[model samples]
Target chain A: MLTLDRHTYEAIVTHARRDHPDEACGIVAGSVGSDRPQRFVPMANAERSPTFYRFDPREQLALWREMDDRDEEPVVIYHSHTATEAYPSRTDVKYAAEPGAHYVLVSTRDPQEVEFRSYRITEGVVAEEEVQVVSALP
Target chain B: MAIEVRIPTILRPHTGGEKAVEGEGATLDELLADLDVRHPGLRARVVEEKGGTNQLRRFVNVYLDDEDVRFLGGLSTPVADGATVTILPAVAGGAGGVAGG
Candidate 1:
């Protein structure tokens, strides 16, 4: 199960909504070995396509370096699906290089309702997990 | 000249879990070839053979110092002694061809 504080949850939802009709992507970083996510980093979708998303190569380098410098890892790798359900698509599964991260998928298909879910995509197998939203992290 | 190649977490298995490995070469291509000699299969993950020519994979981000190799000369990017080469898998994905989005 993936546990997220209310603020972080809201931040992810808001970013997804703000980029509706196009895919939005980002990562939540936390101390290495800490499953808890403490930083929200929204990234530019270089593809900027409604059906595709990619982090700018240069930005990706900087992001990885920052995480390394802080002794952190990507606890949560997230993206939005403007028209589909909150699930990993084939494209998503194929590019899941971080076998240790919680792959979060948010859907803004319904402006009134947001579908938030998490999964572990490892070695071509994707297993969905429960998302527990708490008022704050312990 | 010896270049220090920083391996990402996903590719650590090929490096025997060593985060950084030393390689020798004046160009990126030669460096990868040398890496594969020590860490078998490491080169295959980052470089692909296309139409009888070897090239870096599109999704693997390789940076020489702080500059992305793609913006430089790609596999032919020149490398100097003591340069830091970091490899990162791009964080990317989206709807597939048949998936509605």
Candidate 2:
């Protein structure tokens, strides 16, 4: 299961809503081996197509390098689906290379309802996991 | 330089169901060519001609040591011995419709 603060979850939903039909993608970075998502890095959908999303080549390079320099890994790789269920498509499963990261999918198919789900995609298999949204402020 | 290339399950057919294969080259392009010699039609699926130039397919991503090759000089990226190369299909799909719910 993956756990994150409410603020982080809200941030992801906001990004998905902001991008709307084009599909939003980003990474939540955390300490290596920690499996905790502590930082959010919103990414540009290079494809900019409603049915597809790809990180900008240059930006992805820089961001990944930055994460490397900071000794962080992408703990959660998230993307939004504007018109579908919060599920990984066959293509999504095929491209999942990070075995250790939680793959989050948000569905903004309904403006009034947001569907947030998470999964683990390793090799050719996908397993849905539980998400614990906790309040950080106290 | 000898490098280990992690083959995705969909592309494993090209490697005779092998999950990983050995490749040798000074750069990614040469390395791909080396693999093609062993597995015919393997390069065509991953490589393509776009805008009159040959390049990796838009939907195919190749990474060297966790770094995407596109930002690392693309096909010219230098790959050293003992490095790990990963190949994946670029996956992008969702339901279809206009914006705003």
Candidate 3:
């Protein structure tokens, strides 16, 4: 149900690797026209944590505002699995309040072996889907 | 032999700001008990309930080396000598705003 081009996926993998050992978080914004259901604008996460990440709400709001200015909405919310697989954790499923938003997981433990997976997590059920990233913004 | 456990940022407050600590235990439970002796309230925060059936909060994640504890037999997983354990939390962006400002 979600498609991310190759380039976008690589970018996320790079970010996740760079933040190795620590959880890296971000957002993806895009316009959902009739032709394409997904578009993305990735943003960095700036929060201090020992064993968890907390997305800066203010930064997210600003991003949303910017997307609104551009007539687009935030389509996805993403983060990394530092030493884990690209699967949704129990907490991830429980906190996924936005049903419309795609949940992306980037595994950074093995950057060269990076895996990008998508999910529609709700009420502890995470339904994964394949995604394709494109060359240019769509 | 004793093993070293890496303390995550959230639990740093309890561990007296030490990023990693040493414990004398052959299993994960023994190591955690040893850690609790030095840093009280840590076991309660990391392990939820009395029986350790569930993890504390959803945000917290524990890993032995690069493997997640949830998928690696939960807390009962064995720990070898000098193995490294890491903990991380789930952070995501939503309808909220910046971190500090």
Candidate 4:
């Protein structure tokens, strides 16, 4: 249901790759009245090191509160794949709590070979969705 | 015919660190069954429980050659020769230091 422009998508990919080996995670927040989807705000993965990444619960709670204050929905959640390809781990499936939010992944093993994909994660199944990356803003 | 099944990074430890392995089957079910034979407990990881209308976990996504399997027929989806299937997890961003600011 959300649209991502090419520039914004590329920006996410670059950030994910820049933090290669360690996962990079961030949020995409949009104005409540905006016609198009939200813009990506890349952030450092505090729980991530060069080899591992664990989502920081404190940060996640803070983001939820901030978005609530702004009256804007936290549209999408994004993370990077360091040494591995852009794919979900069993742990990821077990922990996905958001049903409405779109989950995005960026593979950083080969910067030039960046892969961007999105999904809707539920109790135990990951449902894939089509992401439209346009050149111009709507 | 024999087809190569690619394992994602998370499942690599169970697959002996092999990225891709061989499986024989005419359909996805058969292929997965053979995969289970090679690597035990893999099917359980991919599919949590059978008989449910929706098989995949909400956070896990599977793609065949860049196309999502959900849009297709799901587990019943067919795989051809040399096709690459990727299983990806749904990722969300953390709150601090750069996001939601």
Candidate with maximal lDDT: 1
For each candidate in turn, give its C-alpha RMSD to the true structure in angstroms.
2.2, 6.4, 16.1, 17.2
Every candidate's TM-score, chain A alone: 0.99, 0.96, 0.81, 0.83
In model 1 chain B, which range of ten residues has the least summed lDDT?
B92-101
Candidate 3, residue A117: lDDT: 83
Cα error, candidate 3, residue B43 (Å): 34
Task: State the lDDT of candidate 2 residue by residue for A40-107, as single tens digits.
Answer: 98888887877777776556656655876798888999998887899998767756656778999999
List the candidates ranked by TM-score, beginning with the highest: 1, 2, 4, 3
What lDDT is reached at residue A84 by model 1? 91
| Over 4 Å off, model 2 | B1-27, B31-57, B60-101
Question: Where does candidate 4 stray beyond 4 Å?
Answer: A31-36, B1-101
After superposition, which runs of candidate 3 have C-alpha atoms over 4 Å from their true positions?
Answer: A32-40, A134-138, B1-101
What is the CAPRI rating of model 2's predicted complex?
incorrect
Instruction: Order candidates by DockQ, high to low.
Output: 1, 2, 3, 4
DockQ of each: 0.60, 0.23, 0.05, 0.02
Better of 2 and 4 by TM-score: 2
Q: C-alpha displacement of B55 in model 1, angstroms?
A: 0.8
Residue A44's lDDT in candidate 3: 53
Off-target runs (Cα >4 Å) in candidate 1 are B97-101
Per-candidate Cα lDDT values, in order, are 0.92, 0.82, 0.65, 0.65
* Between candidates 2 and 3, the DockQ winner: 2
